[model samples]
Target: MSEDPDLFSAISSQNQTLSTISPERLTSDQATFELERLATLIRHYDRLYHDQDSPAISDGEYDALVLRNRLIEQNFPNLTRPDSPSKRIGTRATSRLPKIAHSIAMLSLDNGFSDKDVGDFLDRIRRFLRLGAQEPVALTVEPKIDGLSCSLRYEKGRLTQAVTRGDGIIGEDVTPNVRVINDIPETLAGSTWPEVVEIRGEVYMTKAAFSDLNQRQSEENGKLFANPRNAAAGSLRQLDPNITARRSLRFLAHGWGEISDFPADTQYGMMQAIKSYGLPVSDLLLCCHSLDEMLQHYHKIEAHRADMDFDIDGVVYKIDRLDWQSRLGFSARAPRFALAHKFPAEKAQTTLLDIDIQVGRTGVLTPVAKLEAVTVGGVVVTSATLHNADEIKRLAVRPGDRVLIQRAGDVIPQIVENLTPEVNREDWHFPSTCPVCHSLAKREEGESAWRCTGGLICPAQRVERLRHFVSRTAFDIEGLGLTHIESFFADKLIVTPADIFRLHKRRDTLINREGWAEVSVNNLLAAIENRRVISLDRFLYALGIRHIGVVTARDFARQYHEWDAFSKMIGQLKSMRNILLPSLIETEEKYRKRVAKELTGFVNIPNIGNKIIQSLIAFFSESHNQSVVDDLLLEIEVKSVHFQQQSSPLAGEVIVFTGSLETLSREEAKRQAETLGAKVAASVSRKTSFVVCGKAAGSKLSKAEALSIPVIDEMKWQKIVKNNGHISVKTE
Candidate 1:
């Protein structure tokens, strides 16, 4: 028995014809040979650029080879194949994501860093296909945006869904958030339109916007983003679409994912088709008929990368002919189709000047290193997160140590490796007490953290708790912003949860407050009134109790079935404390020793976990804490769970999306689905039952096909609801 030689025979046949072509019209064999040659050349360059982050030749030179191959293939169209080098965009996405085979396989391009590299590439094609020097190599060059890669799908001339370039095989569906971008049209306008089209490009935040966003984060004591690329990635990956919508992000389509009945024979023509579809495409795309012309364009882009509004790592070159692209096959990861010639790392070295500690809402102390100004990837780096006391000690970094800081993933600036010599120095001891409140700080055994035990009594902790309680994730209390909370705290109108109830009584005082206008006071008061009654889960979460998170609170509410049961357990712990072993009462200079002994006993309760019990016992044992809890309970009433016992459509199901969608905003849609009982997830696999697809539905759609998941559409969804009796049929 012999191995199947179909693929090898195919390549050998193409190679024979590729060896003979000159300037005259190509025979069918020459066209096929040229296409395969382009694929092989492009795949090699793709690895050189994407994986090694190096290029052997200028992008323009590589583009010329692709263009030449494309021209030949145009004359011989029947030889086109699916894995061609001319049809795709961008590298296959990272493997950490669920794999998504593209709706269309993204291809790679050949590269040429010098005339030699360019000449060699052509020589191989010429020798393989029997071509001569008179046959000119042609190419196209374009800027490669450095940001999150994604695809947008349109159906029936309407913008429907967007997906990240997850693993080249599958991507997380993120249509809802992408829809909010003003630059991303909701509907493709034109009577004559492609039935389905997938536009692929990078989602980028402009440098100016990144700076402004980081500045705002800095002023508000929020986590400062490392760079625009990271900011864009983080913002788009958010589970909440509202966050994405508020970031003022933008999108530009560079190529297509899936095109139906596309009337294009070349890459240049395809770009024109994409633009005509009402999508934003770059105006700087250049067509070069010679390798030298392509190289010229590549140099021009490299010289002007920083001046552009968006960040670009390198230049992208593509083969122009659609037929040639098909003939060119693929490799395992990136396409054998296109290449991205990356610029050298924008990494520079600088000295560590000072280390600063900041307290977060969670009471975790973060250590930051102030750095001497240095340029990293075209952005100025002045500071980086040292992470914690342990991290600093591990590096033995002190003030004035020269450090090599690399922006991790070109986003967060981190001390990659200490470049300075270690000197005999004092150990950077973790703080023993909260810096702001002077309360004891303790690092729990086996945990990589030191936290302030001051809890809510610490003003920093207090302000943070107040902020969390009002944030969109928790109670979503309108009008109770940071300014209002700070003002109320200063005016003594609010100290604990109970003070919120008494705010109305101080209307005159609030109106007369320093920063409050009449309208402000009224609005604040009205917001409080509206939130007087809240859902059991939300109200429980708003308590800001130690060790009690939203998930834990929901669990407790479900188990205990009422706030009284939950509160009664807390009260019982207090009662038990009064009867503690006399040995535990020996509070001396060695207070932690005494506490640790008692902490062991606190963890013995069946349902009371160690973390919860520790936080509860700590809070209750502290002087004036019981009163705060008592006052809060007196001020507000927590509503009982109303819908827990009711039957719901999505009550226990876990759902995830992997493709583009069209029907509703993803955010509102997710919430609607969740409200009905579905648990929305980010990836797709065997666990997924239904996959809703829109235009350009990528690898996940295929995965759904593989897994035999029921794939449906917006109309099918309506019918499902109607059949399930979740919706009523209305008379037209």
Candidate 2:
């Protein structure tokens, strides 16, 4: 059987470079030979781990091989091939289950947050179907179980094998371990059954099992698992089935993937049919007639979250009609017919025992709420983040106030809402002094949060700043984590951002430091050395400047191609504030316009606002801040980015847009193509193919391409979406 075109298409479009690679042209004989050998080895490993669930090599060793291949491919881009095994997510396919490639890629479902988000999903479905408000519909609402996703295959009315959901299409065979599951029947009740049925569900650990596992770990003096979700992931990922069999893993059939035939025409019917085959389907599952009913069902599930035997992160609602499900289809990574509504995390009520302020890496003082011990979401909660002093005042939460705490998706717990008594109020005031350096705290104009006057000298901020510098989103300095950064800060081996660049010079000093060994220090230094040339956007953000997030940094980089230009602009802004004070108070419009003109030269990129401008001014005005910049400049060199204009097949085309593109969202489609060396204009012009229409595609499609841009639908757009990050379409 041939590999599904949709699967390969998505893979190729996602990784255009990989699909286009030719082994013959990669190198002069010797290099090509090695590349082929390495590729073969990597693919074999992928199959071994992904398909068989048995890995011969450790993760570290595997990463080393992949990194080597990446380096080789980077240097010899011409020789690189798209089909290289390095692109696979998990273990490769095994021989079990007849290795049936999916007809449709078993895409994961997209997660939604609040009721509004769920409403939006329903709206999309309604618009897609051109349905009226009175139109009848039904939804299959099931618990979004937190577990290892696995695909179970049944053929000739018998349970054939089980496969791990590896990269959606291909999966690791966990047949041996799956066979032990008593609830999973070996044969169907009735003789008549589909030729093939791939049952998809989550394999999880119950609350009881999770508690026992943690207790055992505690008794052995081993590290306690953070949560049940992580515990389940760790257990299922074991290379040996014996290890898996020992773990009290439970499976719950939530849905089906590939089905040759079924007596039911709706999803709920098929689910019932599967349950008749003696599979363990939870009774909590509900069938709702409308979005409102679905939400109501979700609320009931959320109320009983703590009491549930198994852990569930959210509720999954699928279109009940199978025909509609097929028509609604899926995007590359997720389905369009269904959505997961995540519950507002379980909130624990606790007393605000104390309040403390901690200095961030950027010298921002964040207030921490020390709470009396309480359990939230099955995890013990003791503290929550207040965010800032304003939040504390807003909540009116004092030392004795009872607060509700919530944790989501393994993030830090936060005080969700205040339960402070108005009559017995103890109003908390914002601190005037910096907690770390004892410097005067001041809130810059147009900004709400107070910041420490001290810049890099603030000890608390140093470790955070250093961590941010090495973070994947920032400089991406490998081998440097929070522990290494904290250690270096305590030893005074690194204090400022500049120290990171200079640490390589004192290799012996770092190596000889307490708790520091030869190999670890060397690896850290190597990571630092590799990050010699920082990107413009990352450098801007790594400066720990206020009001600068990823998008802001990217905009700053786009506007000012050179670091010198940006630095000069910062200096000029500082000078202008002092020199042009009289001119600033003219008229609101005049003042804003004049300031904007000067600002545009330095910051005319998208999304730059008044709040950001104020922070930039405050940063440049401080002499200490200037000193840090000078110190950093001496040790670190900012690499100049040469923006090249590349010709793309979709470039310079006026693409007409319409509808809700299921594959790539409208904004995402525009952003993707624009990023991929293509010009994304506001409206369709003469040179547009690619109407790229979605459901309810509007007027633009009718407006003929004045310049000849070809219009395409979501399906065709999906063909180009995969390999190219910018080609990604947004699904609501």
Candidate 3:
């Protein structure tokens, strides 16, 4: 974890070896060990960057770790650990607010860091739909706001619930907090609105607001948040709604979630509808028909990012047509039809004053660089993370050496490179022991980070884990803030997560404690009691496993459906790992095959991989982790996931559209096709049941003719889509 020279050398050498070594050169044990180490390191970094919002590495450096992990996994799929960082999305929902399950999951978008990446994303859509290169794919481009995501559910045109995008599937209810934001409409303007609709958008603080808020915090001796995104999240997640109301929080609608009925069929049209309903929508939204136009819009947005009142990290490009969106479907974590193209990282040069090692809640040691003050992207950079020993060695940075610092998407600053390295100095070495507790800190084989052997005994780790346990996606007990958790932990009033459920037993003592008023204590107890009957997903997420995030936890919940069943299966897997079958009962080859077969089932779970399977098996294999699960199960009920599938007429049919329609727009035509129980594809393929060719039908028409697929004109298409003879068409 030291930013010292010796650690850097170790990392540099290790990375070089990894890069040069072929998959065939590695033994099964070597690959397995490397995969485990990479998984651990990546998971630790993911938590630091995503959950805590205090990233210790640059995006490029992080991407390298992910790339390394991926390469290893690709080479040795069977060696992949169950807890591999690749299987998860953003960090677990670890906030203080109560968790609310989203009616429709609010997924993240895959990133397109370059023009080629964006082009590939579009090309992917084309390939998935069997579309020709020349076919037009209308896309809606908008600024990807670098702010907190919020989902606003409106019933009868009145805003009822507002939730943060905690983990996509579930979020923390912030209805009261958001109700006071001026940008959000209290009621829709139109009478002809859906019975239920969830408007999804970003909750942000203007640059002015962020500056003003930070100034006030400094004056009041309050903790200053890192950036506008952090400040906005803190303000919106305030326990007291009045506090949130006082903050200058703004919201801008971009998309939606669950709806009783959609007002429009295209993304642009939907945005217009949302704006007409009195919701604030971004004026930067543009509809682009070609990849060049999308890239142009992206560059324009990037140029304006610094000038805008609010912060934006990138430009989002989504398939314009709703029917296309539905047909394109989604990946485990993101929509396949949408992408986020991030702005380039901004860099500046500064002297490296010193290197500091900081240990996180999970015991992973991180190296930070103390830098001479330098301006970067309008902010004065004093310090940046070295990431690990390897990053330091990679840059060959030393005290007094000039180094390049980068800030991208307003994320944590990182030392990108060393500008000066000729000055002679002794090599710095990372400590072999934990600085705080004097516990043995060891870097496992093939790992980048050094971790303290101390578990619950380490105060920092203990406090952090407890905080995560009560986070919004976990137990979500109100009033048990980090401050309270620290105080309770220090006093030995609580230790393990199970102790949270037993807090009511400490009522008499807690009531008499300092800063514990009767009303507050009662409310805290009530919050605890309210969450006694929790869902299986939340319960699993509360455990703070290395890589079991909200989405993965939901996957587990859905797959197993019940606590007893999951626990039993995990136990069986654990037994299988520990026991060795006799050759008489079953041949060694057969036993190995059986083990692989069982693991494949776990790995095949959508989004679940060998890394996660290994992590799960390793966790269950441990007596203490199992005990924690057993104890937690005794304290609460784990509800099963009940899926209610909606039936649609376009359930199985795949239809394609070509040319311009006279009566309906391309998007509307696709929507009508979907409404009539058809999947509107981008091109005519063997799977296509019918192709609607309108005026000036192009390559698709020819392809459909060649394939002998049924081809119909606009009038015939309208006749087939109408439910009861006449079609209801909206004029442009």
Query: Which candidate has the top score in TM-score?
Result: 2
- Which candidate ranks first by lDDT, i.e. highest? 3
The residue ranges of model 3 lying beyond 4 angstroms of the native Cα positions read 1-113, 125-345, 444-447, 581-596, 599-609, 639-641, 646-732
- Which 10 consecutive residues of model 2 have the lowest summed lDDT? 11-20
Give one digit per residue, the lDDT tens place, for model 3 in 163-239.
88875777788999999999998898988788998999999999999999989999999988778887888888888
TM-scores vs. true structure, each candidate:
0.46, 0.67, 0.53
Task: Name the 10 consecutive residues with the lowest summed lDDT in model 3.
Answer: 1-10
Query: Candidate 1 residues 1-732, lDDT tens each?
Result: 111122223232222122223212333322333454455555555444432334543433345445555555455443453455555443443323233456864433344334465545545444433335787645567888766777888898887767776535556566777887777888876666789988888788989888888888889897776567667876776668898887878887777878887758888888877777777777789878777787788778889887888877677766566654553434344433355655544356899888766554556555677899987655676777576667778887888888887543211366866788766877566677888898888876665556787777788778666765665435655667666676678767788777887889998988887777899788877877877776666666565655554545565666566777666776776676566544555656356455545654543322335556667666667667678767777867777774354366546555555444555445434544565566666667676656656667788778777888777665655564444525422211
User: Candidate 3 overall Cα lDDT vs. reference?
Assistant: 0.73
Off by over 4 Å in 1: 1-346, 373-375, 378-380, 409-412, 425-427, 558-561, 569-624, 643-732
Per-residue lDDT of model 2, residues 1-732, tens digit only: 223222222222211111112222222222232343355556656565544444555432344345445555555443354444444444434443334455445566665667998999898887666567889889899888977778788998888877777767766566777776655677876765688887888888888898999898899897576566556655666667686676688889988877888769988888888888777887988889987798899999998988998888778999999888876665445677898887664567889998877665555565777889997645566666676666677788888887887664212466777786588544788899997779889986654457787666777666656765665546766666566667778878778777888897889887787777999888878877888788787788666666565556666777787899888878777676566443534987787676766665455454576557767887777787777778888866787665555656554444556777665446556656665556555556554545677787566766644444466677767666555534433322
RMSD of 3: 13.2
Q: What TM-score does prediction 1 earn?
A: 0.46
What lDDT does each candidate get? 0.62, 0.66, 0.73
